[model samples]
Target: MFATPAYAQAAGAAAPTGGMSFLIQMVPLIAIFVIFYFLLIRPQQQRMKKHRAMIDAARKGDQVVTGGGLVGKVTKVDDAFVEVEIAANVRVKVVKATLSDITPAGGARPAND
Candidate 1:
């Protein structure tokens, strides 16, 4: 009236899974990393590179928007600081890294555009 473990012996007869089995198990993790790299990390890196190029190209007379939402014309540009004139004879010094956007001197494009 009792079942024996003789059938359970068949369970242990299976061979151990090899390296290919381990690799298959890792496939989803690898794919996820690749997806994250392409979808998130890579784009952020490219955006930061483009933003760095733009900051390096900043010069005097360029209209700049700061991180704080202040808009002004760049009167002087230095390696680390920029003198921005927000109003007639009113200027403020800001760190170059704080610049968010830059419009060249001839950027008379319609504001509504």
Candidate 2:
């Protein structure tokens, strides 16, 4: 005669009610999303806004560096494109968004110096 004990303790416990349980389980996930928005998304959006402002302020005669690493003087600016003169009589058309940085009013020093 094998007298095995029946594990009936858990069977008598009632199931958790669904009303507040669902909301309670989701609290951590919602908190994580809020944290990510503040730490990651908000900063990225701010950077984008700053970059857009810089791009919008670009003008002819400004020295700018392209995303491709070319430094040139802005010769022309259109709605979506810019013309840059990398060397005397050597110019190229590039997208406005492709510009990464614009030098301040003072000209940049030559790399050799």
Candidate 3:
């Protein structure tokens, strides 16, 4: 076997290091997190907080709309559930978390009256 001798050559310049380099690598990730917090996480949290407060304050005679799309009047409100009258003489017990919208006593009346 015949092999040609090869000489060592200088390598290309290496990237710079230190805090600036670290920041340069992390800036995009940090920016993504910040963007997610403001555009997605923070708003969702605020909406959930508002929804929780509204659900916690629900009371009798309030017109409510369930996540299932049922519109009814809240005849009774418990710690974690509510008795909703979807129709005259027809009531169903539903979890409070399933209530998506709660209109105040004066907001609107149930369709069935």
Candidate 4:
């Protein structure tokens, strides 16, 4: 006759449901953005602001190290450019932004006032 068992249960159970499912789903996405800002964006902005302030404060006669690895004494400073003397009687004009560091006063020849 091929008759089966006495009773059978339902095929399968449904997924669990909750009232705040949408809000819970957004947590990981928001967390990733926060992590990215702290790990990447914040440091970069701070570095740029520091570099801008350093560039703005450049002046003549300060010993400066350039982005190109050249160290020179500043001979002149303009709004957007600087003149560096790398050797006696030899000088080069460079962008102010190219200077990476200005030697602190009293540690080297004072910057022209």
Candidate 5:
């Protein structure tokens, strides 16, 4: 008496098969990846490229800020290292890639003067 009727079993059938279903299921995932690539990955890559160009273009007499927060003038540059003069007769060798930003040719003027 508890068994399902034959007509009820025949009424419930499997869905129609189509090749488009797989592609339809994948659309959301593909969209998410594309969004992430443009919104996050692409911009970060561009910033890194610009930063690398800036680091490569550094030269003598350029004032730069280091990752360690020391602001100094670049006295020497090598393939992988830079000599920065933080103060009179005080110099430190830092990795070229560790330089954070290169200040403009003319530094900020003192407010007092």
Candidate 6:
């Protein structure tokens, strides 16, 4: 019944070429990782680099906007923080990295200026 047992044993033997089958199975997975790195990971890295350069270049008296939507003029720049004057005689300390946008180089416009 079910053919001779010897026939089944012969069919189960390993291939003469060794582990090439296992390597072939991994090719698709490796290709997917490469695609993800180029299409997603690389661009994110470049964007972060540009943002770091911008953050490092920040200086005092730059008109700026914060991530929280507060617009202010930078009064002082510290290694990791900034002093922003949001209103007349009203200054606040915030992290330098929270700055979102730099106003044009001429500084804020006064109501009469």
Each candidate's lDDT (Cα)? 0.89, 0.88, 0.92, 0.83, 0.88, 0.82
Q: Which should have the higher TM-score, number 4 or number 6?
A: 6
Best by the lDDT measure: 3
Of 5 and 6, the candidate ahead on TM-score is: 5
TM-score of every model?
Answer: 0.81, 0.82, 0.81, 0.72, 0.80, 0.73
Error of model 5, residue 112, in angstroms:
28
Candidate 1: misplaced stretches above 4 Å?
1-15, 108-113
- Cα displacement (angstroms), candidate 3, residue 49, comes to 0.3
Q: Which stretches of candidate 6 lie over 4 Å from their true place?
A: 1-17, 107-113
Q: What is the model-wide C-alpha lDDT for candidate 1?
A: 0.89
Cα lDDT tens digits for candidate 6, 14-38: 6656588889888999999999999
- What tens-digit string does per-residue lDDT give for candidate 4 at 26-82? 899999999999999998999889779878877776788999998988888899899
* Candidates by lDDT, descending order: 3, 1, 2, 5, 4, 6
The regions of model 5 sitting more than 4 angstroms off are 1-11, 107-113
* TM-score between candidate 5 and the true structure: 0.80
Mind giving the per-residue lDDT tens digits that candidate 3 earns over 60-96? Answer: 9999999999999999999999999999999999999
Give stretches of model 4 more than 4 Å off: 1-20, 108-113
Which is the better candidate, 3 or 6, if ranked by TM-score? 3
Least lDDT summed over 10 consecutive residues: which range in candidate 6?
104-113
Task: Rate residue 59 of model 1 by lDDT.
Answer: 87
List model 1 lDDT by residue over 1-113, tens digit each. Answer: 69755644436566658898899889999999999999999999998998888888888999999999999999998889999999999999999998999888899633421
Candidate 5 C-alpha lDDT tens digits along 19-70: 7888888899999999999999999999899889889988898899999999
TM-score (C-alpha, index-matched) for candidate 1:
0.81
| Comparing 1 and 4 on lDDT, the stronger one | 1
